[model samples]
Target: MSFVAPWFLVALLLVPAAAAVYVWWERRRTRGAEPWATAPLMPSVTRGGSRRHRHVAPAIYLLAAAVLIVALARPQHDVTKKIEQATVMLVTDRSGSMRSADLKPNRMEAVKAAASSFLDQVPAQIRVGALAFNQKTKLLASPTTDRARVKNALNTLTGAGSTATGDALAAALAIVRPQGAAGVQTPAAVVLLSDGANVRGRDPIALARRAGRLKVPVYTIALGTDEGTLTSKRANGTTKTERVPPDREAMRQIADASGGTTSDAPTTEALQAVYKRLGSAVAEQPGKDQLTSLPVGIALVLLVVGAGVSLRLTGRIV
Candidate 1:
């Protein structure tokens, strides 16, 4: 129940005004009808031949007028347009540490769920790509408008190796970074979903600077509680979620250097909110209404013609 031309609502005032004038005319036409002394015996003729139409015709005409007003106001249904879509890439860590159950069923599951939801919300217009990283980074999907495919890629992520945030980010850029020669300016971005644990390659800060030079913004979506814990299981099938430590400070440095933003969520809803913001930032253009719907305009015209015909038939006997 949304309106494209909300300003059309102001036209409703004419309907009530027309009704009031019609009612007043009817009263004036009927007033003093029996002033004559022989009025009781004098023959009288009602305006309507069919008793049901005494009020129906006027009501029908009013409805027709209302329909015409709305049609002229240019009513539009579900319509959209995509002029420009921001280039968005995702970099996710799938290391063993990502399996910590600090966020929910597990951090890995949360990441998958979040990625899936974000893909679903991406309006089918933006070009989005996804990648996962452990000891090495893999491009799960390339920049595409096919959101379902991207979500399918997210579902394939598994946590069993060490994290390489820097490498993963570099690989994601390789897949998403556009060739700046189409006479087009496409701002690129990467959403880094990680536990802030980096254990491979050169300093993450240096990589962040490189990202800046490449004109790629990196938004960090951190998934962990301030007092979250990590767990390790042995061959005996024993496990525990121990409060090893938190490493937000390291993640912050990467996010800040890339001239990007970071968001922390403790609940699913908060995580969802973070994803929505990131998704919006990545999606540059959405859909819109190009013109008023033809079917509605035709229907209104038919109603007006029907009303005019009714009035003509009523005038034939006069």
Candidate 2:
């Protein structure tokens, strides 16, 4: 919650001041009546209500005053709203390094699970696209509301060639970018997952800069631990084991350039968590909602109830 007119909040002191004044008046009246009547007879003279019941109406009025002061401050809070016609591109790396067994059965398999979770978390109104990249980028499915098609495309991905992070991001931008600027109001975003540095195709940082220019944010996830390794067989017989750690710095740079977030998922659980957050982020945006009327309504109701109680108990409304 936030306040637009914070200065008005100082007026809240008036509530406590009013309470003190009411307390002083009640004590002074009681003392002044002591000369005319004894304490026992004072209750009979007051008649309609007990001392406790008499305070109820004043207490309610004080509450109303406090709430009304809050209303004057102009409070606001964050509210989530679904983005209509929003397009999100899910780009996953199918590079040989993704075949590493650091994350359970394999990195690629875990990525598939996380991507499926992302699809499930995203709202049905959002259009999602699937893209897999290795030595080149492949658009398995264009942006569509059909989750089955995108999931099927994700399932087809397998660890293969070199990483082409830049090219994959570029391909996504081409699909989500507005045609002739007429559809510019439609929101578009890209989520790129990779386990290694760019080894082929275009420069990813450059493409991320282009995405920034197009007002499309590109979220980058660097998956895989420092100890991650990939084993490949040589033509002659023996296998060559090579360390293929995720390029976290590169991912961070890409996200920063595109005005998006960067996440390092060294394990499958962390990757899934990252995707879950991204799913909500891409589907809905936070909007500021003014809550001034809420307190104002509450205050009005409190005042009306307070007035009615005072009139019924004391034959006068304060």
Candidate 3:
């Protein structure tokens, strides 16, 4: 907790001062007792109950005063708050290799499920966009707060052509970047999921460097196992098996160049976990919350209780 006006806490000193005054008055009253003619015959006049009980009302009043003083200082505390506004571009690989059945039903279906779950977990205030890439890149959905639209786009994804990772990143950046002459930058991020190495389109490393210059992080997720394979048809009326494993090193390099993180997900569950972590990173921010009202409310309740106890116990309210 922090205080906006810390000097107001100095008022707390009055509580101890009042306590001292009450003690002194009580002592004086005891010392100044009037003399009695038949002192031995007179019954003792001291209060018979516990002496500590007499000070309850005064103690409550002092505590209320201290609380109110602290409230006047305008205390604050650090709190975890969701991001008010942000843009997230989801770039997914729709290359033929994504059809591999290594991850459950298929890589593409697994990716879609994990991505949908990620979208659901994202805060409503964040705007999300979708882009699918193969031999070419296409924007499936523009940035918007309507998550249903993004999910709809994800459902329409299909695997075909070759991996165009660079073009996909560029398209994602174009969608997330602000459009104006002033070129004002907003808080934005990109999440790329791929199951194969780049085989077509522009240079992914160059695109990552450009994204870094624009201060946009491009988190990369490599989704596949080393033993993954894809069956392809040859021109001579025959089929051949091709190894299509996730290029983790390339993805890591791209992420590093763009000032982002990289992860490898061999299964759908691991992919979803990675997405959940990324959602937390992009959807929430650190903030401070003012707690002055809390203390003030507590002080008000204490004041009422103190007055009620004083009136019930003693004949007058403190």
Candidate 4:
């Protein structure tokens, strides 16, 4: 156990001195005692409940002193191994159809929540950027390690326009390709969250094919349950959910063509699974070395032992 401030150890020298003073005082008190036929009974009388409580006092003092000394040395702990730096980019759909409430609240809201969690779990070394798209895709932030900016960009998005899978994919890859160092990992990836509705530009399948050639894996998150539902607000107030078209399988195919697997999770939980899988499948880079857990653990042991000793001296066995 390394000390944050080693000077605190000087306090321990007081323990032996305090013990000597206690022994000296005990011997001086006994020197004046009178001899008696019931001399052995004296110990029993002194050992009654009240006397027992006093027996714990010395231990308590020792324990308190120990705690104070340990507290003087600060401690900290970390168990998880550190990860290396990496870059990740995401392309998400904000098409008009994403406004559907099939995924609860709406598809886009669910996507936003899932994206935020994924971003939060990513190691600090990983640079992440995001793209939000409808008719035309827009780069909300360049690939950056400043996570707050990426998440802020995600939260500000609102759904509108028609779905354009091709333009969005091409544009997102454009953002990822140049950011990578020569011979270093593409470091960039594309996670497309949509219902597989490709209406605005080129064919989505063709884009997926292009991604496969570019070594970019396009992971797809298919949103909605069987017999999908949609909610739209009318001019006269009030809202309602009605059965809408379902297109889960098409999204899955997009994933397959792009060398990425697809899974169905109609709720926010699905998005979580998707993001977790992405993290697990991807590899991290390299960086700085630091310590963890060892120092904190030693301090904890000392604290527990001192506390136990103090409690035992208080008349109850620890």
Best by TM-score: 2
Query: How would the candidate models be sorted by TM-score, starting from the highest?
Result: 2, 3, 1, 4
Model 4 TM-score (2 dp): 0.56
Candidate 4 Cα outliers beyond 4 Å, as residue runs = 1-85, 179-185, 233-246, 284-318
Order by lDDT, highest first: 2, 3, 1, 4
Residues 1-318, candidate 4, lDDT per residue (tens digit)? Answer: 355666877887887788678667655544434353256665543323343454455654565566566666543333344346555777887766677777777777888888888887777777788888889889999989898899899998887777888888888777776543345554446777776477768777887877776667777777766666666777889887766443667677778787776777677677787777776544442223323344345556655665565455444433
State every prediction's TM-score relative to the real structure. 0.58, 0.67, 0.64, 0.56
lDDT of 3 by residue, 188-213 (tens): 88999998889888999999988888
Report the C-alpha lDDT of model 1 over 1-318, residue by residue, as the tens digit: 345666876897999998999888866665644455254532344354353455566776677667666666676545443436567888888877776777788777888888887887776767888888888888888888888888889998877788788888777666655453244556678898877578896567787777777767788876777666777887899986666243667778888998787787665667778888777766543334534556366656666665665666465311
**Any idea how many clashes model 4 has?**
2
**Poorest 10 consecutive residues by lDDT, candidate 2:** 178-187
**Cα-based lDDT at residue 97, candidate 3:** 91
Clashes of each: 5, 0, 0, 2
Instruction: For candidate 3, list the clashing residue pairs, or say none.
Output: none
Residue 136's lDDT in candidate 1: 86
The model with the greater TM-score, 3 or 4, is 3
RMSD of 2: 6.2
